[model samples]
Every structure is written in structure tokens, then in C-alpha cells.
Target: MAAVFLKLDRFALRQFNTAKYAGTRIFFDPDTFESKVNEYYGERHALETEFGDRPALVQGYAPFCRHLFMPNFTGAKVSVQRITAENESLLRTRYEARRPNELPVLVRFFPSEALGGESALPVARYLDVILYSREQCLKEAQAMGEEPPLEDAPWRIISIKAQDEPYETPMQPITIMRNSLIGEGGSGVPLCRKKYAEAVAYWRERAIIT
Candidate 1:
């Protein structure tokens, strides 16, 4: 089985939801998706000759999920279902509970990128939820050692405020994807953190502003 990783940045989740439904402004480029894909997979020989050796690039779920959620509601919802299935049985139950009114949707299963195999990865899964209070959010973050920012802070911080809080209430799961870190070069060094940081930096530099 492939290992999957989950990344839940509270700041990014807030930004995603706000921009998604409230007409808030967030910076992202649709065309960068292709640029990003090329960066991860490596440049074409023709493009490389034209542009010279570009920076070693990496890509990950955060930005990809953001792009995917914009116009693809069904896909986003299904992704949420997969993640929810892992923990709360209620989501699956509720989904099934409404099968009379809600029709089943097809979900695509792509091979794990980290494992480079045809089998699905089962490491970490992604989820986005909104809580009722900043206090609650802060509490969860503190438990996870991911405290939110003070009112004056400039950078956005996402934290698991409370581990014991109910998964229900105002919170609703958004999208989920399996994550994993796989080592390259047989040295047995874990490369997930390095790749994740590289991917984050790539987007940060592009001013893609996530």
C-alpha cells in the first residue's frame, strides 16, 4: 500500500472558502497549472532549449486542489466524501441517507504520484472545514501546535484548534486527496518534506498567492 499524506493549512482553507462563495479576492492563475505540471514532470526538450535550465520545480495538492474546486463541484464533493469516509461514518451514512434525492457520482482514481504505482495511496487525506469561532479554531490549532495568528499578524495561519471538538456543527468537509512521501535515489532518506517545501515555495514565488 502506498503511504498518503494530508496537509491542512487553516489559512489556506479560509482563503479557499471565502474566495469560492463570497466573491473575495484571492490571487491564482489558471494557466500556471500547465506550467506547474511541466515543472513537476520536467520541461519539454524544445521548451528547455528555448528557456534554458529552469529551476527544479515541484507541485503538490494545495494549489492543485484550489484549482480543482473552482468550477468542479462534483469532483470536489466526491473528494470530500473519500476523506470523510476515513473517519466519520456519519458522512457516508448521511450521503446514503439521501440517496433517494441525491444520485451517486463517479469518482476518478488516479495512481499515487509519490509511489509511482498503479495502486491507490492510503496515507494522509486532505479536508477543509470551517468552524464557528476563532477561539475554537485557535484551540484546535494549539492542540496540534498550530496556533492561529493574533489579530495583528500579517500572514495567515491554519491550526487544528481542538482535537476533541465535534466534526459536525457548522463544519462541513470540502475536498480530500491522498498524500504520501516517497524516497528517491535508494538512500532511504525521506523526501516528502523536501518536495512539499519546494512545491510550496514554487507557488509562493509565482505570487500565485495561496
Candidate 2:
């Protein structure tokens, strides 16, 4: 099975387990979660609309581009979520034990710190706090490396892992628009353009535009 890339946005993630001062926030309307899976199948644009302004979601574009542009690269199904530490642990354990033949697991992290100031609150600041806390967590994890509880999972950590290598920022407009048109045939081109126009108009109206 292809790997399922779990993409989490800042608004969906909670604060670090041990970081009392940092908290995460979601960017989409909370109500969207009530019927995400169902609506996603019927109207894929709904998902793009939900992710449009999120910088974290935008970051996925670079990896996606590599997958699309590179030869012989297998594609992956992208899924989004907002989960707590306990939920993450539970999911990881289940996937590892089951080793389901259908799909590979690729968990991506979206820190609130990356959301920047385009959002309503101090998203970037909160992310910085979370990062600081995460650094501490990593140090502890490294120290406990050989301990029974410190065993690491086998999943490939990409799309969200902290790395020193330089990466070109993904092109948000092209990715969202192009992905929206997938499977729609030629008619989607005009429709995508219209949607882009509407997005521009909406941004102009809010003046809170991306």
C-alpha cells in the first residue's frame, strides 16, 4: 500500500506534552471537522479551502512536487488531522502492530509556530515556544536512547521533521489549484481559474489576505 501522509495544521495540533506555556491553534472553521471525510469525497475543493491560508499546509507542496516531478517515485495519499500526544502514540502503536499491508505510515507535524502573523493570533510566537519545548524533549529522548521506553518506531518521518538541509518553499497557488483539478478533465482548468479569481476577490475584501 502507498504511504498515507498525515498532515496536521497549526490549528489542529495541541501544545507539547511537557510545555505548559505553549499551545496550538487550528486555522479552519472548527465545524469543518464534523463532516470532513464525507465532504472530502463529494467536494474535494472543501479540503483545499480549509488549508488555503495555512503555511504548514503550504509546506507539503515541496515534498509533493518532488514526488510528482521525480521519476519512478510512488505517490502517497495525504490526510489531515489534529491530535494529542496520547492519540499520536495510540495510532503509532496500532499501525506498527497491525503492519497493515495496504499503506505505509508517514506522520507529518505542523507546528503553530510556522503559521506566522497572517492568522488572527500570535501563531508564530506560540510555535517558537513549542519548538523550544520540543528541543528539550529531543534531548531527553536522546539521553534515554537505550532504555526500554525510548525505543523508536519504524515509520519514515518526513514532511514534518526538523532538518538542517535547505528546502525551497512550495508554491502554494499552483499546488492547491492544480490538485483541485485532478481527475476533473479539461473543464477543471477554467473552473480552477474562476476559483482563483474568487479567492483573490475574497482576500481583497478581507484585506487580511494571504
For model 1, the run of ten residues with the poorest summed lDDT:
177-186
Count of clashing pairs, candidate 2: 4
Q: Which stretches of candidate 1 lie over 4 Å from their true place?
A: 1-77, 80-129, 152-210
Which tens-of-lDDT digit does each residue in 31-57 have in candidate 2? 332133223222433444686532322
- Computed on alpha carbons, the lDDT of every model, listed in order, comes to 0.26, 0.25
RMSD of 2: 20.2
What's the lDDT for residue 33 in model 1? 27
**Alpha-carbon TM-score of each model against the true structure:** 0.20, 0.18
lDDT of 1 at 116: 34
